[model samples]
Target chain A: MVLLFTAGCRAKVSESPIGPSVQLHAPLGLPPVPIPPDNPPTEATIALGKRLFYDIRLSKDNTLACATCHDPEHDFSDPHPISLGVGGAKGIRNAPTLINVAYQSSQFWDGRATSLEIQAASPIADPLEMNQTHKVSVSKLAKDPVYRKMFTDAFGSKDVTLGRVERSLASFERTILSGDSAFDRFQYGGQPTALTPAQARGLALFINPIKGNCAACHTITPQYALFTDGKFHNIGIGVNDDGTLKDAGRYHETTVKSDTGAFKTPTLRNIANTAPYMHDGSLQTLEQVVSFYAGQGNSNPYIDREIKTIHLDGQERSDLVEFLKSLTGKLPPNLEEEKSHP
Target chain B: MTRFYSRLWLCLPFALVITGCKSSPPPPTAAPAKPAVSYFKVDPATAGSVSGKITFSGRPPARKVIDMSEDPACVAAHKGKAMEESIIVGNKSGLENVFVYIKSGLEGKNFETPTATVVINQGGCQFHPHIIGVQVDQPVEITNSDPVTHNIHPMAEINREWNHSQGPGDPPMHRKFVKQEIMIPVKCNIHSWMHAYIGVLNHPYFTVSKEDGSFTIANLPPGTYTLATWQEKLGTQEQQVTVAPGGQAVINFTYKGRS
Candidate 1:
């Protein structure tokens, strides 16, 4: 929860702590993150949001907050495949990385949520997660004049509605775009020194529709680096641990049969940084992920018919993993260690 | 073939029992060869679109920390963003998305296809006209833009079950409801946020609110009928509206807080 501004922050960022910070340009290959015109990213908002991100005080028992499950050191992902809620309650789905989420169209694997403004408030009251109610959280924040002042400044007026929280959180999150990486340099920058031969081969197979068809959802564009199409697909990973036939995928939301076992195709931009891929977080390692794809997904009734086991060996898996590794980007510069919490 | 005839014969009695209004879009499914119904002549007149907005009555709920249910993929990815909070626009509308439409009585209106077809396009990765009301048994085209496949799944009790995928640049999906239904939940089998409401009324006397909270149902027959507004969390309310022949009737529905 450290919000320390390292020495590099003042030197690199164009705006120190003013209206909206335009220090880090949106990576070449993506649309400029569309911040809501009403609530632009103010330094105070970012600082407050960051504090909230790391503040365990938001929970009922003061055990967890957003950061307890999502760690910046681990590419903003909880190292555990699935996250544990308050009182060590085990959740059904694995924790997803918050990296490059500003580009996403909808929230959640099933696409049940349409906006970050809507998705942000789901966890606090989820019995299995924070196990806290919004009334209590707001009551606690009401006690803190600093938080109240920040909320009013960030969102005008002092009601401190949940919508503002979602928007502010979304605004802070909008800054977490992932683009600058070796793969980016090699592909967009045309720097031959960036990508290794094995990585280049892996990239080719990824985009080559006949080979990897990775472009089917994990799209790479000249405007944006290789992330994803922000669409859901059935990659054939099942979470039987939850006693689900195929996790119901997007079908659970829409009640459509074709969506029976589909899930959102997550961005592969931070693939190197985000371990344990897939909606269920079943796959542990990148090697295992590529191998799963090579093997055409886990066998299940609702398995996507497109899940065809193809030919891939250990070496190819390693090569693909190497290419994915090339996508690691420089961390958000000048991260201050969160003020040591009591 | 004999079995199909028997089923068709069984359906005939039902149609006769409740013969549709004079201008039914498609014939009653009494018999495929000689349906016991009338097809509404396609009208060349322009139809007005109705839209409005919904606001809350009290302080909306704060962001709830959502848990990643059984799916680890969702858990790992949404550790921070999940169940954060829902957007509460305007004052205090508890729930945002509300499916509002003429519940009944419109099922027998004379419905004729119009030259100007409403698209209800899927643009910017969201379903346009989040709440859509169309004449029952009319082809509502679902189109896609992003270079990926998206499946359209409509959960309705009255409509024939249909689920299909439209690829990028694929042909528009022409789906029709054979019967009248209301507040039919429409969602993309692909994305959860891609939600929509299809008001499948047999008549054209229905409309939805825009983001600013205003709506108008055009060409409504000059008559006093019950007008209703319903939000998801805030329940429903009804008001009587009267219109003269070829004259417009102005009606305003204000939710007394969450109605």
Candidate 2:
């Protein structure tokens, strides 16, 4: 992806791109991103990971790829309620947006995997997903002379292992982080005119504890504007009619009774473009999601304590959703146009 | 003439109440008693038991090594090598992880739900105990010790089927199986190789075979009962036996391997 630097925000960013260890430019007010010591981000590894991310051969039936579900045109998220996998098989949860995913502490809707590298292998072998075994995928890549050279360029040797595959994919995903937007310009860039009067008012209500209270989970600090706490909570989606959990959310992972129906809190960055919100994609529009919060979410026993009644009238609700729309920013450059595919 | 005067005196009180004078109502009568229900109680002194051993006649297959290259946390935990436990055979060709329980008899009995927690630990991307038995309504605590995330999904036939993802340091999950379904398969959706079986029963007379393939069910009242054994790969076996007061009934099962 192309990293464009504008004249207005150069003071807020510190970017340094080296050979095998590229230090990504942190947007204004954000902390330095953590990188694993062993799998340092080299330009070659990032390039290789980009190819694997978009290649359809990663799946058993070469019909689907990571890009098939996380389309760049849709802000790296599936527009459908659930992602469609091999043989038209459907996933159980909605595809989360990859924007600002580098800042996330955990991965997946339930936060089952801890890192992007680890999460890369799950969909490939999942029977209802890519259905391609890691062993077989590595052997397929080994036969190709181009992939073999690329592997040697990224790692010290050309020997292909499943670990290398995950590392490369993670490196590519780390480059997909988002930051710059109207909200960032207004808050961090010291641009007074970036947001409208309605948006400014909406931002106020969003942080007000008794008002929108959205900042409780989707934090909006002046230092960085990620608009997410990166924690999990159950906002009462996918709950059974009798108050029992239908999906069981984080509870399925932790076995904690209180975590029932809890899912990772996704970033509000570029949320307007990524419609069909929530873990289940049950809410079609941002306005609907705002309304759901206004009504204090669905009545479930395990609903997050922060999801209390927000007494917002119709006009206030619309203003809050408008503020969420201002989170849209420039997306990563399209990888399909790159001429590096093998 | 005297009896006629007495009857006239009794009618005079009612006649007076109709003339604007208030009178009190009659008192209520006692309700009829309900029939008592007979509940089955163990006579401890006369309780019997059924003990058995599960044996395999054929050669055990070589265990498969798990490939955890995708997640380094799991690989590091296992020190780069981990084996599958689909069919664990101990000494003397005894098979482990078999669910043994009393299938029939002891009707009209009410067994108290066990309050003790049954723990199933997930470490190195595999269940610590591949097989577990819990009485209906008994708490089962599922825990994860690895630094990575693991999702636990129980595919129960006669009970609620549910799935959840658990990350490292998260609190242990507590659940109860409310049905008497045996061999409810449990799997980790994240790691395909991670699997376990849970046996839920109405009575507490059930035990999973240890590493030696031996199991004993005590506190069985003196009666005729059908003992059942279940294995994931091998189907199941049932045997009828009668136990005398404080006597032990020996029932052994043998499974022949595929030739």
TM-score per candidate: 0.52, 0.54
Docking class of 2: incorrect
B34-137, model 1: which lDDT tens digit per residue? 65545332221432223344555455556455443422333443334544322434433423444445554344455543222345566544566566666655
| Angstrom error at residue B114, model 1 | 68
The sequence of per-residue lDDT tens digits that candidate 2 reaches over residues B1-259 is: 1222133234433443343232343235434474222224456688888988999888877778987655555788777579887777899988887888889996677665555677888898888678888778877888989765566778888987766555565478778888889889988755667889988888777777767888777767899999999989888999998999998999999877865
Q: What stretches of model 1 exceed 4 Å from their correct place?
A: A1-24, A157-159, A239-246, A334-337, A340-342, B1-259
lDDT of 1: 0.61
- TM-score of predicted structure 2, chain A: 0.91
Q: iRMS of every model, one decimal? A: 14.0, 14.7
**Highest lDDT: which candidate?**
2
| CAPRI tier of model 1 | incorrect
Candidate 2 positional error at A176, Å: 0.6
